[model samples]
Target chain A: MKWIPIILIVGLLAPFSLNTHAEEKSSEWVKVKGMVCEVCAYGIRKSLMKEPEVQDVEVRIKEHKVKIVYKDPKKSLDRVKLAQILEDAGYALEGEKP
Target chain B: MLRLGFFILALLGTSQISVAHPVIFKGGIELQGETQKKDSAFSTTYTFSPYWAVAAQYYEMREPSMSPLGRTFEASTVQINHLLKRWWNEGSQGNIYLGAGAGVFAPQGLPSEFLARGEVNADWESTTLYVAARYIYLHPDFSEDVDFKKLRVGFAPYVLEQEGLNSWFILEWRQMNTEKAEVTPLLRFFFRSVLFELGSSLDGDFKFNFMIHY
Candidate 1:
């Protein structure tokens, strides 16, 4: 009866530990905003091509955002670098974290 | 006399009055001829559509080289047709409609013509043109030597498109009653809310047709 509490605690902590370790291994993603038309969406997709680790990039005009899926977990795409490229092309990028 | 009888036959076999309500009705004229002797003729139609429609037509012919009727003869007729396929829109252009209807005929228009005719037709559309092939059963009221069955084909092209303030061209072709073909080319003028056609057929036959639409 005393071991029951210990088993419950171990079962609950196991999932949290696995999740924390996965978060450590996988790079965090920040969806860049500001896409209103086909041209704006294509511009963001073109800028994403410079990142070698970017596995795929998709821009949703309805939500005005771009999702950058990356293959490498150790290295994340720099948002500041992407924001500068967007600024040069007459657009504002937001919700990006270093 | 044989020609007039056949015109009535075509009308009775084709005109069915199931869809004749007072508000919307469709009608038109089709005449065919070439040179001087007009060979064949048929048309005026109203369709409630695939479920219901009625059509009427006329046919006349005179061959001086074959029949002893000189070069002057005429047969005018009116027939009602019911469509085999129903509920099709009556005003849509470029659709071939197949149907059957029956109507009566009074054979007294042009002298030396006799016969009341009934017919069924395959009416179809080709781009801006409408064509029909009809099989007419003829019954002569007077005892004159005319054939019992007359096969006819008719064509009318480009019924729409107003060109240059109501001036447009129409081409019509028909083979009727006997095995003779007639081709008529006409120019239509729409003025004062009325349509008028001036043309000549292959047999040196010339005439004018007029109609008014409300």
Candidate 2:
């Protein structure tokens, strides 16, 4: 009975505790290539939305740019992982690697 | 005004935008439908690669039809088109596309035949103004070939969102084969995934066109 009470309390508080540890604000302006049409913009946005860390996305069709905001202040995301996600969605970075 | 406009597009489409950007991006699916008088067609295209796409279209005539097979007939087309190249100038925002398409014309009650198509398209756009022109040729096995052309100039009176509604005022001219040219000023509106155009020609004829992308 004692173990059961402790386990219940820990399970209820784990998610809330984890949320407070790595609270960081990060934003990046991703220059995406081959976005000449509206569908291209939509597809890029949709693919970026799949990232659990991503909280906001703005796609500029004419400029071929995608602005992304990722949550979690302490832990920054990997640029290579972001590039892979974009490539799988049928697009590439505009200027340089990552 | 119309004659001056036509001359400008003819000059620009021949030597301009085609040099900038040629092809749209890969991984796009477009569905288009057009109805004129008693004839209508539904077409859908899926881009399989960066510069290649397969298109399927079904056209039908309801009444007073002028089809190669008969007055009333149904036809379908399956084509594969590719963007050959694109050109962009040092300080230009518009691009040009040159593409070729080869397809089969399957008319009901007749043998399926092959057709070849060549098209040149150019467009220049800004925050408010958009101008586009395209010339297309369809060469069939029979003498019933087609020279189709389109010119459109649009102005946006309002700002639009990516996932919301956008509206534009477009003046368009379309010529189909040997018929008289049709000129209309239409209201072009689009949401995130759907586009609709409605207008009327000077002769009181109404026009409706729709397109969807996924």
Candidate 3:
């Protein structure tokens, strides 16, 4: 009766309302050293993928940069910590974050 | 000959190709094949962890005159390698590896003997230059211990400096124990993650090596 229209309106609006708090993470590029071959790149990709906060990681061979996409802003993706990760994985950190 | 063929078949099992590379990352599969005038060898390597890898190989010598095994024989081996150390110098990346392996060597109509394998490798590479050396020692119950030495110097005339195709010119020297050494001039090309090399030994033996990783 009178309430049917109101119920339809709420249903249509509910789907849009729940997504308001969803956040996106930005991609960051980190420079790395000792990436002379694909083996080095594979090592980087494998290690980075293991981080629960990492969404996607790409290795740029020529530039020696790794593009990382984090899970969210709540998770910390400190550049220094990233340097340590790569260093431990056999890649040397050559320059500051680019 | 039949035993050799069966041994190779057992090694291949279901695979079509075989492997070689100085470096193998953890959790990768490598297939390798090597052929000489009268002998052929096939091998596979699996890197199980960041510091460990396991390899299996089957080798057959077709010519008894060329083989030191006293007769034509076939051998199968399984070896393990570990990454001992890796260092970066300026912009050049280098690594050193050491590993040991043991297997069984069987001569036709003869008892199978235990075989031992040992390897040491080092390599350094930049965008345009690559240098590497490797030593392998194999001692079988049936023959004199064999020592293999290899050295390679390569230069990339065209340094793409990006994720594309890079080409290199390589000169390689290989010696086995006191036998005559063979010099090879080679061309190496890398596209993405796969590397391929083609060369001819000075004695006119064609050689090819290919590598890839997941």
The top-ranked prediction according to DockQ is 3
User: Who is ahead in lDDT, 1 or 3?
Assistant: 3
- Candidate 1 accuracy as lDDT: 0.42
**Alpha carbon lDDT of each predicted model:** 0.42, 0.59, 0.69
Each model's backbone clash number: 52, 10, 4
Question: Candidate 2, residues A1-98: lDDT per residue as tens digits?
Answer: 87998999999999999987655658778776545445446666766777788887888765667888877645455667777666545556654342
Model 2 C-alpha lDDT per residue in residues B1-214, reported as the tens digit of each score: 4323322332222111111123333555666666667555565666666556665555455543344334443444455655554332211235465666565544445655576766677777654677888886667675366566788888878554444666889888877666667788888877665677888877667877776666
RMSD of each: 22.8, 12.2, 9.0
Better of 2 and 3 by DockQ: 3
For candidate 3, write residues B77-118 as lDDT tens digits: 777877788766444677788878887777767887888878
Give TM-scores for every candidate, taking all chains together and pairing residue i with residue i: 0.36, 0.65, 0.76
Off by over 4 Å in 2: A1-25, A31-40, A50-55, A60-65, A71-98, B1-25, B60-75, B85-93, B106-112, B161-163
Sort the predicted structures by DockQ, highest score first: 3, 2, 1
The 10-residue segment of model 1 chain B with minimum total lDDT is: B15-24
Lowest summed lDDT across 10 adjacent residues in model 2 chain A is found at A89-98
* Rank order (by lDDT, best first): 3, 2, 1
Error of 2 at B213 (Å): 1.5
DockQ, per-model, please? 0.01, 0.07, 0.22
Compose the digit string of candidate 1's lDDT tens values, residues B1-214. Answer: 6445646544432211110111112222112221224334444444332234344555444554533233433444444444443122222112122333233323334334344655554543222233434444555454232332222222333232221224546665644346455566767555323455677876656856554322
